[model samples]
Target: MSVTYLEAIREAQAYLLEHDSRVYIYGQDVGAFGGAFKATKHLANRFPGRVIDAPISEDAMIGSAVGAAIEGMRPIIEIQFADFSTVGLNQVVNQAATLFWRTETPCPITLRLPSGGTSGGGPFHSQCLESIYAHFPGLVVCTPATVEDAYSMLIESVTLDDPVIFCEHKYLYYHLKAESLPKDALPLGKARIARAGRDCTVVTYSAMLHECLEAAEEMSAEGIELEVVDLRTVKPLDTDTIIASVARTGRLLCAAEGWPWGGVNAEVISRVVAEGFNLLDAPPQRINAKDTPIPYHPKLWSVHRPAAASIMAAVRNVLRS
Candidate 1:
């Protein structure tokens, strides 16, 4: 039987709860309601008291989870949406992100953000906040593109003794599927070469990886090879793998679902220029969501975020440059 990306996430939580007594779940409507996307469906019943329902306040949720982590408990906190996480920005950045640095206490807390845009989700419910979280110190921001990574990385996040931002795209919850969960995966902080090519590289993460892969398949008939790299974790970025991909392809195109300015795209390009300037045959290019609020209309939302055709155009532009 095939497992979808959403199911894989649920399995990961199940794994954590069954294996680790210290690991508990805290979120809004998670106990009986099973979460906004039902990612935590039935976990409350299966794990009994381990799965809890938090107050509607995002700040309180993170704050309480932080305290739990301090007392040697690993807490998996789920925000209803990526945009709502902003409400707990202070706790994440100042408290959880700084716990280790300030007093050497391990804040083993996992914040699962159902990120990225879905049709009609609008600005409030849909957003990609990976770049914002990745900017801070002592936080590991993971963007799992595949079903396997979604399961494995989340499990890994709970195991680590630091704050982890789990950016699981909402679009892939039902759109993507896998035959089975991976027994072994590339270690966290490493990238995967989703598709290899010699002409140019497309560096992306999360749901954007699907669009880049689609672009790669479509452009193959035109004799334009496109290499695609899935940066599994945005914060602890794998610069070595990314630079090597650029060295082989001689060009880079960074595509992301977030806005273009100062995002993962910009971070990748800056690193390549600083550390692998000699490897590029041409300047790197990027394509991202337009600089505006996420539109509610499906038609406008489709064009707002980077898609296969837009990724194709960016890749072609980089190759031509």
Candidate 2:
């Protein structure tokens, strides 16, 4: 039987709950409601007290999770929406992120943010804040693109010594699926070459990875091969892998679902230009969501985010350059 990205996440949490007594889930509507997207469906009953619900306050949830982490517990704080995480930004960036540096204690908390845009989700419900959290020090930011990574990375995030920002794309929850859950997975910080090519390199993560792959496939028929790299974790970015791909292709294009300014796309292009300047035959390019609030209209939302057509156009521009 095939497994979906959402099911993989739920199973991963189940695995964590079963193996670790210290691991507990804390979030709004997470207990009986099974999270905003049902990523935690039936987990509360299955795990009992470990899957307790929290109040509506994001700050309180994060603060309490940090406290639990300090007291020898691993807490997974599921913010209902990625956009709502801003309410608890202080606790996440200040306390959980700086705990190990300030004190000798390890803050092992996994903050799950249901990220990315779904049709008509609007600005409040749809946002990708991986880059914002990645900007802070002492935090691991993971953006799992596939069902396998979704299952495996969540388990890894909880076991880490530092805090983690787990960005699980809401768009991929049901849209992406796999034949089976992975038995083993690549380490968290490593990047995966989703497709191999020589004409150009497309580095992307989360939901945008699928778009790049689709664009690559379309371009292949036209004799333009595009190599696609999935940067699983944006913070601990695999620069070596990205550089290697650029080395082979000599052209780079970064695509992301986030906004254009200072996003994951910009970071990838900046790194390639800085370290692999000589390896490139052309200037690296990037495509991101339009610099505006996510629109409520389905048609407007579709064009707001980077899609296969946009990625293909960007690839062509890089090739022409």
Instruction: Evaluate all candidate structures by whole-model CA lDDT and list the values in order.
Output: 0.94, 0.94
**Can you give the lDDT of residue 263 in candidate 1?**
79
Residue 200 miss distance in model 2 (angstroms): 0.3
**lDDT over C-alpha atoms for residue 215 of model 1:** 95
Clashing pairs in 2: none
| Residue range 50-88, candidate 1, lDDT tens digits | 999988899999999999998999999999888999999
In model 2, the number of clashes is 0
The TM-score between candidate 1 and the true structure equals 0.99
Pairs of residues clashing in candidate 1: none
C-alpha lDDT (0 to 100) for residue 33 of candidate 1: 87
TM-scores of all models?
0.99, 0.99
